[model samples]
Target: MKYTEEHEWIREEDGLYVVGITEHASEQLGDVVFVELPEEGSEVVKDEDICVIESVKAASDILAPLDGEIVEVNSAIVDDPGKINEDPLGDAWFFKLKVTDLSPMDDYMDEAAYKKFIG
Candidate 1:
């Protein structure tokens, strides 16, 4: 898993990536109430806003940390947005992307670095 400065996280498997907000973000958001994910097959670039996560506190944009095409969205979260607070990095993943290139991943932080960054 890798993390973006904006508090999003990405984990890759078999060339596809699962993307979501980090736990720190969920805690900050204070109970997600809604999620607006990008349509599948839509192309996105790094740092672009691809989704919206609204909580009681504020509505936050979930940015793409790498260039890719969205291939799947987590419908489960759309139906029950609180899943993000329960498991932000796991079952609550917002979408999957078919990465256009792997090089940009190097710019993201690993777990330890991310922890420090949030601190």
Candidate 2:
């Protein structure tokens, strides 16, 4: 998995990339209460606000980790926000992206670097 300083994670699988918030991000947000996901087929640019996550403390934007067309969204999170805090790296995933440009990943951090960045 690769991550952004903003707490987005990206993993490529069969050409498309799966994106979500890291466990560290969910922890910071406390208990998640709402999730706003982008529509399928919507185009997103790197660093753009693709979704919004509302927690007990604050509402944070979920940034796109790469330029791509949204292929799918995890509606389960929208329906049950607690999944985000309970299984951030598993059932809490946000979206799947059909990537357009792959270069931005070169600037992303690996797990070790992301852990340091979050620290």
Candidate 3:
């Protein structure tokens, strides 16, 4: 898994990259109330805003971690936004992308570095 400074996590599985906010981000956001996810099959560029998350404290955009086509979206979070606060890294993953080029995955921080970064 890799982590971005924006508090998003990236995990590659079966050729797709799964994206979700970190535990720290979930806590910071408070209880999640709403989620707006992008359509499946849509093309996305790295760093583009692709999803929205609303919490008791604030609303935030979830950025595309790499250029790719959105292969799948987890609508479960939309129906039950509180799931994000409950399990951010697992069942609360926002979406998965089928990136053609994976070189940029190298640019993100590893778990150890990300912990230090937040510190």
Q: What is the TM-score of each candidate against the true structure?
A: 0.96, 0.96, 0.97
| RMSD of candidates 1 onward, in order | 0.8, 0.8, 0.7
User: Which residue pairs collide, candidate 2?
Assistant: none
Candidate 3 RMSD to the real structure: 0.7
Which candidate number would show the highest lDDT if scored against the true structure?
A: 3
Residue-pair clashes per candidate: 0, 0, 0
> Which has the greatest TM-score?
3
**Pairs with backbone N, CA or C atoms under 3 Å apart (clashes), candidate 1:** none
Candidate 3 residue spans exceeding 4 A from truth? none
Which is better, 1 or 3, measured by TM-score? Answer: 3
31-108, model 3: which lDDT tens digit per residue?
A: 999999999999999999999999998899999989999999999999999999999999999999999778888889
Residue-wise C-alpha lDDT for candidate 1, range 1-119, written one tens digit per residue: 99889998989878799898899999989989999999999999988988998999888888888888999999999999999999998999999999888798898899999999988
- What would you estimate as the lDDT of candidate 3? 0.94
lDDT, candidate 2, at 97: 95
Local accuracy by lDDT, each model: 0.91, 0.91, 0.94
